[model samples]
Target: MADRPEVEISYDLERIDFERTSELIRASYWGEKRTDAINRRAFDHSACAAAFIDGQQVGFARAMTDYACFAYLCDVIVWPDKRGAGIGKKLVQAMLDHPDLAGIPAFSLRTSDAHSFYEAFGFEVSRDGMYMRFVR
Candidate 1:
């Protein structure tokens, strides 16, 4: 059979079925700071969301937001096998166009190498920017 048509774009958070989503995320994420527990927690909170394709969850993104004013893009990943498919753009555009998350005063994320990628979605960094972290 010819290749099946790709799944349409959709957005969800912990609300989507978990086992499948988690399984896809496990394969998609292959970075130094990766952990199942961390991934679980990342989407478990209400502040995050994901995109599923053919029920396989080919892309994922999450944000830290108060839901009223601020949103910080935290995790954005697309399965290695699914790159060049335009899923990443659709995924992020869904979040930015979301009614629940519109009008965010600021959206923030830091990447060692994705400056141009995030820039496609209107993200920019200033020379005065600084980030601080503390032990919990």
Candidate 2:
């Protein structure tokens, strides 16, 4: 396990500013055009957590949940410069600890990399689970 950074974990800055968050995500990822959609989901879900370094959003992880037994962690990314420094883990931990997200029977995510990183939080592969995205 990587050592945690000295940054503070928070759920307040989550999706607060779409323009800013969108820019951060776009810069971190390989130029995906989904800010409007991301904003819509973030606002619609109304339950997310973010990690900030000195009040600046360096990492973000969000979850959509029924406050019961299901939750999906989505759009988890940390700034490129912040990668490999434990910020992502901190952000994820913060989201899982959010008052609206805690105690869910299951929390899930899909990632192309960072399997070991996510596994640090006890996330494991489901032998029979598969995700199908309907883009209509």
Candidate 3:
């Protein structure tokens, strides 16, 4: 098999490809009903991590954070053709490592089918309900 191209993860909103990011999110089970305007608003208010391969946007993830006490990770998606290539992991890591989010007390996310994926990053299934949490 050929080697995969390097994936570049960026937290700069200016680096995001809005159209492609919206398309990937809208295709996800969680964001299927989200409108372009809503997605744009969300990205505008959140800290985003966008992944690129050869300068083409391929994955995205964002965190709604107060940058103080808590953060909620959401809208994580990778282009269909790019899934399983570790781009998603890189995006999430970028979000977690982002200077704005460093040392936050808690982080949470909701994922119906990707529990194990998130778990690998230290997120645990919350006994409280559908959310998974990573507490520091």
The numbered model that scores best in lDDT is 3
Better of 2 and 3 by TM-score: 3
Candidate 1, residues 29-83: lDDT per residue as tens digits? 3334556677677677645555667676677667777877677675667667887
Residues 21-79 of candidate 3 have per-residue lDDT tens digits of 89878888898999999999999999899899999889889999998999999998888
Range of the 10 consecutive residues with the lowest summed lDDT in candidate 3: 127-136
| Clash count list over all predictions | 0, 0, 0
Candidate 1 differs from the real structure by a C-alpha RMSD in angstroms, to one decimal, of 5.9
Model 2, range 7-115, lDDT digits (tens) per residue? 7776664335566666776665433766667666664665666667776767777776788877777778777788878787777778777887677768776666656
Which structure among the candidates has the greatest TM-score? 3
**Candidate 3, residue 37: lDDT:** 100
lDDT, residue 33, model 2 = 66
Point out the worst 10-residue segment of candidate 1 by lDDT: 127-136
| Model 3 backbone overlap count | 0
The lDDT per prediction is 0.63, 0.67, 0.90
Give the lDDT ranking, best first. Answer: 3, 2, 1
